[model samples]
Target: MGIFDVRKIDCHAHVLDPLRFPYAQGAAYRPSGQEIGTTDQFVEVLQCYGTEHVLLVQPNSGYGPDNSCMLDAIRRYPGIFKGVAIASLDADLSHLRDLRDQGIVGIALNPTFYGNDFYADSPALMEKLAELDMFVQIQVQHDQLLMFKPWIERIAVRVLIDHCGRPTPEQGLAQPGFSALLDLAETGRVHVKLSGYAKFAKTPYPFRDTLPFVRALVEAFGLDHCMWASDWPYLRAADRQDYGPLLKLLDTLFPDPADRDILLWQTPKRLFGFGA
Candidate 1:
């Protein structure tokens, strides 16, 4: 069977359906009519690419902490989906425990939209997450990575940096921010998602310009610490990007079958607790 035929899990994707689960009043942005805005539509797209499992991230479009849509999808799909939710910084332990029971394995922190202080102020909540053995998924601009170093050092929960830390080609690998991310990986508790290449890619398609940074991450973190993802629906490039090409890029980048297997299957299976 081809690599694409393997039971791969997309470690990051968003599910949005404004019709049934309307966007929050204070949402950051609303999904356009053209976007794939429902769980069934999102699943159909994943099916077209041969993906069976997905990690559904609560979209910023639902600005508030309500994750009804994401939780419902996990309930509907059972083993086929897991989720990362966005909760209020002041959310009590009871709310968190309830989220855990609902199959949420992680909490997402996006400093870019919510401001850096949200995460900095939530150490207690972070501790609760660690106690629950849940992961903390962070999305921050590259330059802001250094500011987050202290949190990384103190938090005991597993950290999953989104979009390869969203570094730019102009910053290169040695920049202090990107360098800080590399340093975090050495701690062994941190994992990096090989998603959103299109966000940082200075070139088209295969996004070769971003390869060096990816190679550096794999080197620093090793195969076990790396995981593959498709930021599906491609959001900005919904009409342009297809899921198949992203999977094909992995085959090209990690030519060794063993290494490719880790990126495509093994690492995500372990990190996301797939089949566990």
Candidate 2:
């Protein structure tokens, strides 16, 4: 089969069903009243884009630490879905173990929401996650990378930094935080997701402006540590973003078939424990 023909995995996406799982009162943001990202719709989108597997990240808009929606989706669609949940640093081990038992492979920490010292404040929790062999999925502001570096270095668990460390195109590759991010990848424990290009891109679709950052990251981390994802339901940009084009970016960025396979399938399969 051709490389692009092989079904791929989307390492990041969220399925929100407000009717059944209402948004938390203090949610950071809410979906349009009329539109909800249901699992079935998300699955349809994945199928349309040749994605066979997905890692559902708990939406901060879902408010509190209730991961019922994401966990339920995993239970209902075993093999097709895996998840990363948001839990407080002080959460109990039993609760975390339960999440692991339910096919949650990682814990998500958003420093943008939880503050810069989230990792530092949760050393015990980080150790527990390491003990469980679960990875930490982190989303932090671009400048926070250096601050997070020491904690990431000391922690034994695997870490996947979201949104290419959320760097802006204007910042350039030499920006201290992004440089630190690239340096972290050398540790062999850091992985970066090639998602959220639109968030930091200075220009419109095709997002060619951000290609240099993607290329630099790939060069730094290599295919084994790099994975591609479509931040589906693209939130505010939903009307503007589509899955096919996003998936095709890898093909455009990585001309070699083997490199495409690693970014689209192999790396994620290994990192997230997806079945062959």
Candidate 3:
């Protein structure tokens, strides 16, 4: 069977229906034009791609801490979507439990967008997440992974690293941040998303410069600990990105059908409780 005909899980994407749920006050960036992926649009697009499940992440742009848009999508489409929210650093445990009940499976932190200092006090929230069996999804660039070195294991939660650590392709594989992410694989508690190559690739899509980094991640984390993501709507994107072409890249990356199954289906099902 072809890739699309096989069961696949998009472990990361977003639901930005600003028309129904307006952007938050002082929201950092406003996603306009092609960046807007309404809940309905997301469902229709994924349906066309035969993606059976998705994890909708809250974007810092337009929605900020107001996870109403994402939460609303989860509620509206019951089983099809799960969420990674953006509750503040020291959010209350009870509030987290409420979010969990509302289909939020984790928290999303963007050190790349807000910087390390903004998340300095995150350990408290980290501890709470572990207590509740929720994960923390982080987006960082360059050496920023080093900043989380101290806290990641201490809290002992399932950590999802976004966009291949958003590494600098010019830095080669040894760049400290990406290297730190590689090392975390040994801990058996970290997972990496193989998406967003366009976000950090100095070269354009197909993002050939990022190929070496992805191979290294797959080698280090293993296909069992790594999964596929689309960063749908390609928000804040450097170039135009769409679902089919991005999904088709899987064949090039993993020529073996067994390996493709592991990345696109097995890992997400095991890690995030996706699919039947």
Model 3's alpha-carbon lDDT is 0.90
Best by TM-score: 3
Candidate lDDT values, in order: 0.82, 0.83, 0.90
lDDT string, candidate 1, 145-263, tens digits:
78777777887888889988888788788988789999987678999998888887878888888899999999999989988888866665624777788888887788888887787
The digit string of per-residue lDDT tens for model 2 on 133-175 reads 8888888766887777887889898898998988867879998
The lDDT, on a scale of 0 to 1, for candidate 2 is 0.83
| Position 76, candidate 3: lDDT | 90
lDDT of 3 by residue, 96-128 (tens): 999999888899889999999999888888889
Task: Tell me the TM-score of each prediction against the true structure.
Answer: 0.94, 0.94, 0.98
| Residue pairs whose backbone atoms clash in candidate 2 | none
The candidate scoring highest on lDDT is 3
The count of residue-pair clashes in candidate 3 stands at: 0
Report the lDDT of model 3 for residue 207.
87
